[model samples]
Target: MIKIDAMMVCLDLSDIDEKLVAFSRTICERMQVGKVYFVHNIKLYELGDDFREMFGDVDLAQEVEGNINDIVDEQFANKTAYEVLVSEEPNTEVILADLVKRYNIKLTLLGKKMSTKSTGSLGTKLLRILPCSVLVFPETASFNIQKVLVPIDFSDTSVHALRLSKNLSDQLGLQLEIMHVYRLPSQFFPLISEEKAVRKAEEVVKGKFADLQKRHNEIAGIPYTLVRAANKSIAERISLHLEKGRHDLLVLGLKGNNPLPSLSLGSVPTEMYNTDINVPLWLVYSEEVIK
Candidate 1:
């Protein structure tokens, strides 16, 4: 049984709203998460000198703590039991990682805008270092998991993501859709036509998918699709598919076929993270398998 004892939520006070809190609550209810930790890190420098001077004698930390409590009360009032942690750490990512370890967090939820401004550096770093899975919600996304899309590449990370997605689908009665995007070689000896190249790529993808199904027969009964396009980036193809399929959630493995043990974030997943896809994305990282 997969046990998710606690969930950690990183809240940006600049954009605290009821919808974001509601989304977090919905996920907690769906995942049956017991305890929710709401964490916010304050950059002392960002607090203007005037503000600091005004509260110089007073404990600015306490004032920030009160503000966080008020926000929680306004948003999650009586909805769920949660604890708030306010830190003055300059590096919010470090603070978040420490909290995750301290709380043994199983999942980290983050709300981010679908704009270039939101680099998602904190979420990305946590996904790389933390043992827990990271769930990123685009500002416009709702906490819905009706139909899930998992892109696989036949690697251990992909397999781990597939397994987890299957488990979630089974538990939540969600429609699971598996897809594999392939690119044909740019130059072939005979210079095959585009149509023939596409056909060949489809055959290869189907064969690999079939082999995966055979390996995991128990969950292989679900529907899977093959996407083939020449000279197109995987992230671009994935974005197109998400737009067309209207999948509520995208489950992705954190690392690809990179042999480097220190390369925490895979290129594909990172690109997807940076993209402005307006769907909730679940980044799965298998610590045991990856290490």
Candidate 2:
């Protein structure tokens, strides 16, 4: 099981901070997290030339920390051991990586803005830099988890993610389901009709699932679905399934069996992170697997 004893929440002094703080409390209560760290980065150098003159003798770091404390104390601090970390460092990824290591953080929560079309944000970088797992909450994400979905490719890493999802689902009394997106090989496209191709894909997936159950007994009784990607990408198919099933949370493994002993986010997850998926995504990274 993934140990969520300590989690750090990245906050920017924006509208999403409120939702991030509120959701942090929910995660602490549900996952039995012992400590919560509210972290923010204030790039003082990037401020306007007259920033200090305008705010004369004001400690910007203190002020920012105070603001975060007010929200965290009001919405979150009472339930768990909490601290506010406000940094003036220009490199956010570096500071966050240090904090995670110093605090032995197992999970990191970040808020993503879903309005834009770009994804070169700090959250995306942190996924590749930090050794711990990450959970991202879109601005419009709800504070509840009624249904959870885990998209797997039947790799050991994905199966491990499924096990974690199963444990969480059982603990929270929520419905849990797994989905696998399959694609018909192009070699058989001309020889076989679309119907036959789909049937063959389903049959292959069923057999694979049966083999997976035999290998991993913990996933035997959980419900699973096989989605065939006809004209859509794997990420698109998963997003469609999430919307159709009303699943508020998505859990995925970082990558399928990578030979290099380093962290790398897979294409599907990287795509989901970059696009406007409009849901909270949990990317489970097993440092031990790569190490």
RMSD in Å for all candidates: 2.5, 2.2
Per-candidate total of colliding backbone pairs: 0, 0
Give the poorly placed runs of model 2, Cα more than 4 Å off. Answer: 1-3, 117-120, 256-263
Report the lDDT tens digits of candidate 1 across residue range 1-291.
Answer: 355788887777666345567777677666667788877788887878898677776776677678777877776654456898888888877778788878988788877775656667666676666656788888878666699999989998899999999989888889999888887777683677878888888888888888888999866698887887546789889989988999999999876234553476687888898888888989887867433
Q: Give the TM-score of candidate 2.
A: 0.93
Residue 264 alpha-carbon offset, candidate 1, angstroms? 1.9
Please provide, for model 2 over 211-247, each residue's C-alpha lDDT reduced to its tens digit, 9 standing for 90 to 100.
Answer: 9999888889989998888789999999899999999
Which predicted model would earn the best TM-score?
Answer: 2
User: What alpha-carbon RMSD in Å does predicted model 2 have with respect to the real structure?
Assistant: 2.2
Q: Following a full C-alpha superposition, what root-mean-square deviation does model 1 have from the true structure?
A: 2.5
